[model samples]
Target: MDEELKKMLVKILENQEEFKAEIRKHTEAITSLDEKIMQRTEALFDGYKINSEKIDELTDKIDDLRFDVNNLGIKTLKSENKILELDRRLAK
Candidate 1:
């Protein structure tokens, strides 16, 4: 009976050692995956920042163009008024 107990205890210890090895392997794999995910996430964030900057630049350019068009419209109206006045003088 004592020999049987000793055999069972040895088997349990061997199983425990194998379980520990497996856990170590899984931990290493998890660490590698985490590093890869972090690298990709950082790259994606950088791309988003660059694209946002480009969008802001385009918005500013569009605003400047709108301002120029409004000023041109006003100048065109004044020129037309002057032309009309000259035409009236000529008629007189």
Candidate 2:
């Protein structure tokens, strides 16, 4: 009976060691995944920043183009008026 008890006690100790090992493995895996997630999140933020800057630059360029187009339209109107005035004078 004593030998049987000893065997059971030894088995329990072995199982405990296995359990600890498994826990360590899980902890390491969780830590690795956390690090990878942080890296990906940082990369996303960096990409967002770069894209935001590009958008601002494009917006400024579009504003400048719009201003130039408005000026061109005014010039076209002035030219048309002058052509009409010349026609009136020739008719007279």
Give the best candidate by TM-score.
1
What would the per-residue lDDT of candidate 1 be over residues 1-92, giving only the tens digit for each residue? 99999999999999999999999999999999999999999999999999999999999999999999999999999999999999999999
Off by over 4 Å in 1: none
* Model 2 alpha-carbon drift over 4 Å, by segment: 1-6
* Cα-lDDT of candidate 2: 1.00
What Cα-based lDDT does every candidate model obtain? 0.99, 1.00
For all predictions, the C-alpha RMSD in Å is 1.4, 1.9
TM-score for each prediction?
0.88, 0.80
